[model samples]
Structure formats: C-alpha cells, structure tokens
Target: MHVLCTAGHVDHGKSTLVRALTGMEPDRYAEEHRRGMTLDLGFAWTTLPGPGAVAFVDVPGHERFVSTMLAGAGPVPAALFVVAADEGWMPQSAEHADALAAAGLRHGLLVISRADLLDPELARDDARAELAARGLGSWPAVAVSGRTGEGLDALRTAIAELVAGLPAPDPDAAVRMWVDRAFTVRGSGTVVTGTLGTGTVHRGQELELDGAGGRIAVTVRAVQELGEPVETATGVARVALNLRGLPREKVRRGDALLDPHAWPSVVEADVRLHGIGGPAQVPDSPVGLTLHAGSAAVPVRVRPLGDDVVRLRPDRPLPLRIGDRAVLRDPGAHRVVAGLTVLDPQPPALRRRGAARRRAGTLAAASGVPDAAGELSRRGAVRTGDLVRWGVPGPEVAALAARVPTAAGWLLDPTRATEAAEALDRAVAAHDAADPLDPGIPLAEARRAAGLPDVALVAVALDRAGDGAPGGPVVRDGRVVRAGDDGPPAAVLDAARQLHADLTAAPFAAPDADRLAALGLGPRELAALERAGELLRLTPDVALLPDAPDRAVEVLRGLGPEFTLSAARQALGTSRRVAVPLLELLGRRGRTLRTPEGTHRLR
Candidate 1:
C-alpha cells in the first residue's frame, strides 16, 4: 500500500476529492462536516487499477492549521496537490507548496479540482508554473470534478503510475513510526495511528515511545491496517496500533514508537539548511524556532554555522539521524523558515575560540549522507551500535569489518590505530629505560600510558604494533612486553651467576643479608634468579643454591634418620635462622619429617 498526503489552499476541494475517490467521507468530526472544510487531518483509501491499495492523508488547507498540514505531510512519501479551476493559486497554496518541498517530497500529482466550473487548462498551466518556481515541475497533472466525477478515471491512472514509480522501502529497516493520532477504545487501553515508513510491526512486539516524557517502553497488543486486524503491518501503509502500556493521554502526537536501541535521542544536531524562498528566508541569529520532522513539532534554538548550515538545540531530545530532513518554521509569523538535512546528530562541543567558525568549515564539505569510513575517521573510534543510531544502515555497519579494525564492539580509525600503536611503543620503551630489571608494564598501566579508554584496546594496539617488527611490543602474562624479552636483565643475570658460585662452593651456606646487599641482589633480582632456577630463597633474608634441600637431606641421612636443629645446623654450616625455616620447607615438601621434640627425620 502507498500513502500520500494532500496539499493545497483552503476550499480547494482536497477532502472532497479524497471522499469521491475512496467513496467515504474524510471529514470525521461533526464540526468539519457542518462547516464543509477540513479542520484536522483526515484519512481515506482506495485501490487503484495497477497499484492495488493507496491511502490518502487529507490535511487541512486552512492557515491556522499549517502545523496540522505539516504533521500529515511529514511521514507520507508522495503528495496529491490540489488547485481549483476557478481559483488558480492562493496564499495557503504557496505555503503548502513550500511545506511539501521542505519535506523533500519527490513523487506527486497535480489535480485541478472543480474543472466543470471553468477551463481546467488555465489552472493547470498556472499551477505548473508555480510548482516549477519551487523546483517541482515534473509532476503529472489531471483535471477532475468531485461533484460530476469528470476525468476521475484519468486521475486514478495518473495516481497509479505515480505510486508504481516510487522507490521501494526496506521491509527489514528499523521501525520508527511517528504517531499522528492517539486515543483509547472502550475495550482496548490505547491506540495510536501512524504511517509505517519501513519495517514490520507484529503482535506482542516491544517498541519504545520517545518524546518529551523521554523514552517509555510500549508493547504492541495488536496491529491493524485499513480497518482490519492483521498479524503484521509492513511499511508504506497506514496502521493503527493497539498498545499495551501507557494511557491514551500520555501518548501524544509527536511521540514515536521505535525499535529499542535502534535510534539515538539527540538534543542538538548540525544540519545543512535550504531556505524556501532564498538564503534570506532562514534566520541567521540564535533565535527561537520550531522544528518539524515526521509527526514531531519541537521548539528549538538555532545557531548559524554557515550560509547554508546551522545548529539546532531542541527543547527535548529527538530520535533523529543523519540524512533525515525536517522543516524549520517561525511560529510568530506562521511561515516556513527553512528545510534542513541533518549532518551530525551527535556533534562535538564548541568550547574553544573560533570553534564554531572552524566547525562551519568542516560541515561545508558534508553531503548529509552516512558514510562509515568518514564517521569513524572523524570520531577516531566509536561503537558499532552508534553508527546504526547515526543512520548508517545495518548493512553498511556490517561492511565495516572489511574497511577498518574493530575490537570490543568499537570501530577504530586507521590513523587512530596507528597512533595508539606508536603510543604503546613509546610507553614500553620508556618503561624499559627507567627500570632495566622490570620485565614489562602491566596491561592496565599500558592502557593508561597509551591514553586509551578501555583496557581491551591494549591488546588491539599491541597487535597493530606488529609483533614481527624488531623489538616490537607483545603481551606476556597480563603485561605488554618487548619481543624477544625472555629472562631477567643482564646485570641481574650476572649477579645471579656470582651468587651461584658462592653457594656451589659451600653447598648449604645460604647468603646473608650483608653478602646479598654487596652483590646488589634486591628482592626483584633475587626473585628473577629464583624464576631462572639458579637460587632458592628460604626466607626474605636467606638464599641458597637451587639443590640445597636435596644436599641437606643427604647430609642428614649420613647422620642417621633422626637429628636435632643444632646437629643439622652444624652439619650444614648455617645459622639457626636458616636451619629453622629450611627444615620447615623440607617437611612441607615431604623431604623430611619433624618429631615432637623439634628434631628432624629424613623421609
């Protein structure tokens, strides 16, 4: 199904034409029926010959309801612009035309209504010229009379051709249905109607309602399309959703029902602006304005960044994305201010002097299109989900794997990755130079040294450093180390050799604190020797050869199975401090057994 909105001046026969085409009255309210003019948005549908089903959102053409007209036209893809034969064009006609053009409506048809009252050719030519001035001259034109049904068949044929030529919407796109109407039924709790531009809505599906109240969780109790209950409703169709959560009054017209986590709620965005009449039509100061996108009309503060670009700070966070188009209006003048194409939904803060001017220069090159490489490079790094929220479609995000290096759900820029790798190299080199005996820096410390936000990025930088490079960084035992760094420093190894020579001469004579101090064997150096299997530290103060315990066992065996501490110390030529702990270590290792009298027995 295709949905199209009506645009024209008041009393231009927009609703009358919709009623005649669909065989149903579009004016639902009693006041509208009596007044013979649309006061609010109305709905009607019909099946064209080749297009199957088409829906018309009959919007009011009155000047007072201009916001109402924008609300209807924002979500619909095509338009049915009406012009009466007797009245060629009017003030409301120009405003509505500006609205349709500001909305970026590409497919539409010009209908000259009440053709029986005068020659429709004159009205058609004037309408065409007016549309041509607004850059909409290619649309097809038809003459029809709602009262006499003149040229109704040709009008249907023109609509059928227009609907058939529209670009197909992605059924798998993320769901973001802008609510146009909301109410409560006696049986059902709440119901909201919208035009589902893409994606599908099914029964029991969960969606988020984003608006001034912030985002609230909502569930789909049921789905209906064209006044009939359905299991699912696909996009480009008018749908009424039976919601499970929130009261009818809470769900307002500007709220949106969206796929959870699929959109970013932004309070400020940078946009490329296009004025309706000319550059002068857009305000240049930070003046208060209203921004209308989809079914939302929000008050905003504007800051001009360039001649054709501006920054908007909305009163409330909006679920907007890159490449999304919206209309800016001045409520005081009740006029269309400008059209905007979003460039960045999440922009950096302009805190430094001349930042806004520099930002203007940066935004001047933007095409208002979502490019994965460009976005990642601009931010240095970002989460993959953020790209989706910024309006790069899921397929483009998936394609990032081939374009950049991703780690821990983040897409990294190539230059940023290279800089991180260089930082890691500098950190390792600085650490090694400061302490030659230190093996490497801890992973967390390395992450901080590299100025990375996440610890997981440490390994990524190490990998990017290229381990095969000479003396490149590598991870070892939770520490980032230089490649080919296997053992202790050369100075520590030389000290270990001297300690080994001393213990080898008098097997069990452990080194004293004074002797170890002379050899420069500190705790770290001693521990390094212990790791290399060259020394065994009985305690912080006692150190001996690695095989001292075995040699002591053999010596004790020579003195028979049982021996006292004094006897063992005399036999091993060591002090009581070394004898006591060494015996405990032997007993713990099952090499010797201790008696109740504090004697030692070889196992």
Candidate 2:
C-alpha cells in the first residue's frame, strides 16, 4: 500500500476531491462536515489501476491548524498538492509548499480543483510556475471538478503513475512510528493511528515509546492495517496500533515509538542546517525556536555551530539519529527559517576555551563521516556499541570482522593496530638503548608512548608486533626495558674496576651516587652490573659486591654484643660514612641491632 497526503491552501477542495473519487466522505468530525473545511486530519483509501491499494491522508488547510497538517503529512511518501482553479495561488498554499519542501518531499501530484469556476489551463499554468519555484515542477498534474466529476478519471491516472514511481521502504529497517492520534476503545486498550515509515509490526511485538518524563515500554496487543485486523503489517501503509502499558492521555500526538537501544535520546544534538531561501541570518546567540522532524513539533533553543550548522537543545529528549533531516521554525512568526541535517546526535561538552570553534571545524563538512572502512580508519579503535552510536550500520561493521581486530567487544583497525604495535616496540628499543644495564622500560611508560588506554590494548598490539617478550626490549620487571642485561660498556669498564677494587678493600664500604657518576658508571651501569650478579645495590649509595654480604655477615658475627661505631670502623678499616650505612644495613637484615649506648651488637 502507498500512503499519500494532500497539501494546499485553506478550503481548496482537498477533501471534496478525495470524497468524489473514493465514494466515501473524507471529513470524519462533525465540525468539519458542518463547516465544509478540514480542521484536523481525515483519512480515506482507494484502489488505483496499477498501484493497487493507496491511502489518502487529508490534512487541514486552515492556517490555525497547520500543525495538524504537518502531523498528517510527515510520514507519507508522496503528496497530492491541491490548488483551487479560481484562486491561482494563496498565502496558505505557499506555506504548505514550504512545509513539503522542507521535509525533502520529492514525489507529488498537482491537482487543480474547482476547474469549472475558471479556465483550468490558466490555473494549471500558474500552479506549475509556483511549484517550479519550489523545485516540485516535475510532478504530474490534472484539472478536475468535484461538482461535475470532470477529469476525475484523468486525475486517478496521474495519481496511479505517481504512486507507481514511489520507492519501496526497507522492510527490515527499525520502526519509528510517530503517533498522530491516541485514544481508548471500550474493549481494547490505548490505540494509536499513524503511518508506519518502515519495518514490520507484528501482533504482540514489544516497542518503546519515548515520552515526556522518560521512555515507557509498550507492547502491541493487536495490529490494524487500513482499518482491518491483521497479524503483521509492513511499511508504507497506514496502521492503527492497539498498545498496552502506555497511557492514552500521556501518549501525545508528537510522541514516537522507536528502537530503545539503537537510537539516542538526547535533548541536545549538533545539526548541519540546509539554508532555505530566507533573509534571516543564522543566530549567533541562543534563540528560542520550534523543531519539526517526522511528526514532532517541539520547542528548542538554537546555538550556531558553523555557517550552516546549529546545536539544538530541545526542551525534551527525542529519539534521533545522525542523518535525520529536520525543519526549524520560529514559532512566534510561524515561518520556516531553515532545514537541518543531523551531523552528530551526541556532542562533546563545551568546557574549554575555543571548544565551540574547534567543534565547528569538525562539523564543517557534515557529510564527511565515511562508510565502514573509512570510519574504522578515522576512529582508529572503537567499541562494538560505538560502531552503531557513531552512525555506521551495525551489520556492515560486523562484516569487517576478518579485516579488523576484535577482542572482548573492542574493535581495532588493522592499520592502526600495527602502527601502535610498532610505536611500542620503538619505545622499548629506545629505553634499552639508553639503559643497557636495565630491564625493559616500565609497562606504564610504554603504554603512554603508544597512546593506548590499558594493558590489554598493548597486549593486542604486542601479539601482532612480532617481537617475542623473551628476546625483545618488552620485558616484565614492572618496568619495560631491553630484553637482555649485559655487563657495563667498555667505556665504563675502568670505572667498574675501580668500584670493585674499592668495595673489595673494605667489604662493607660502598661508593656514593656522585662518586659513581664521576667514574662514568651511573644508575644504568649499576642496574646492569646488579642484573649481571656482579654487584648488590640495597640503596642508592650502598652497593656491595656479590660476596660482600656473606663476608660482612661473618664480620658482624665476630663482634660481641656491645661495640661502638668507632670500634666497627676501626675493625673494618673504612671511613665512618661507609661504616655507618653498612651497620644500618646489618641491623635491618637482623644480623645486629643498635644499643642505647650507640653501640652495635648481634641480634
């Protein structure tokens, strides 16, 4: 079934034409039947020759109720633009045309009603010019008289051709039906009438209704397509859904039912606006306005992002996506100022200086977000949820499983993963080059250098880096460093010899950090020497040869329970500086303990 809506000036014979063709009254309310003008949405259906079942959404043409017109027209695929023959073009006609154009409506038919009142050809020519100005001139048109049924068959043929050319909606797409009407039946629960944009709705299917306070879970009790009970219904058809768990009064006209997890519920979104032919400048400051997308018309605050980009802060969060189009209107003046293309549904908070300008630059090219491969390449690494949140179709991202790296719900582009791995290897290599005597650089430092978040990301990189841990600079000592710990370099070999000779002369004595640096054997050389088992460094300035600890243990064992610092210095034949630190180390090791009289003794 194909759903189409009528758009024109007030009392332009929209309902009369539909009634004359369908053999059924289009006006449903008593006021509309008495006043002979549509004040709210009216529905009717007919069968076209080639198009089969076609539904008509007759919208209000009165200026006071244009909101009703928009609610009816937003979901329909095509439009029947009605124009009265006597009235060539009116104010409401232009306004209606603007609404259709702002909605990006591409397929339509021009019907010149009341053709008996004036020359039908002249009226058609004027209507054609007006539609051409709005970029809708290519549609099929016909002149008809509802009073005499003149050219009624020709009008049906035009509509059939229009409906035949309409593209079929994606049956598997997520359902986001905007509620145009909600009421309660005596036997049934809450029922909602709307045009299902896409996807299939089945009886007892669960859906989500995003409303004022928060989203409420709703279930479909039964389905009605074209006023008949059905078990299943597809897109491009008018449906009346009997829903459960949602209050009929709380479910307003603009509320929509959508996939809860797939789309974001955000009050603020960055949008790329399409400029309409209006003189209004893009607001530099926050301006109060109304936004129209699908069947939603709600108040919002507009903040300009760039030349044609704006950030809309709606009074209420709505279910929206990245590529959705919307119309912006100044509700006070009731004028269509511009159309918008959603750039990013979720944006960063403007916290730092010049953040807004930088954000504007990111959104300068609103359509620049590339497809699957390009998105992965741009983001470097993304989570599975991020793939959908950033607007990449979930199935397409899933298809890249073999091409990308995935672990624990994280996805990394192959090129980015390789680059990070190579960077980590370089960091390890550099650390090893600087400290030949030390273990690999600390894991923390390597992760920071590679610009990764956690150790798991590094692990994924390392597995693909091809540098095995046993032979490479990436080792585990709490610090990442070169794989091997060789002896000091030849330049520092003399320094090392002096240090060894001095330490051996007095086993408990050691060189300070300055003395080691003077000999060109610094922390790295010391670390290397210790790793090679040539020296034991308990403190920064205290280094003992490998056999020194055993010899000192014996030295302290010979001392009685009471011995002064001077006595130990004399016995060891070392400076007080060396004797003091050595005695402290022995005390810590439990070989001796300090007495109250400033003496050392076996513990």
On lDDT, the candidate that comes out on top is 1
Global lDDT of each model? 0.86, 0.77
Model 2, global lDDT: 0.77
**Candidate 2 local lDDT, 267-321, one digit each (tens):** 7888877644443357544766778877788888987766777788988998877
Which segments of model 1 are wrong by more than 4 Å? Answer: 34-36, 277-282, 357-365, 431-453, 465-467, 484-603
TM-score of 2: 0.73
lDDT (Cα, 0-100) at 110 in candidate 1: 95
Tens digits of per-residue lDDT for model 1, 159-188 = 999998999998988999999999988889
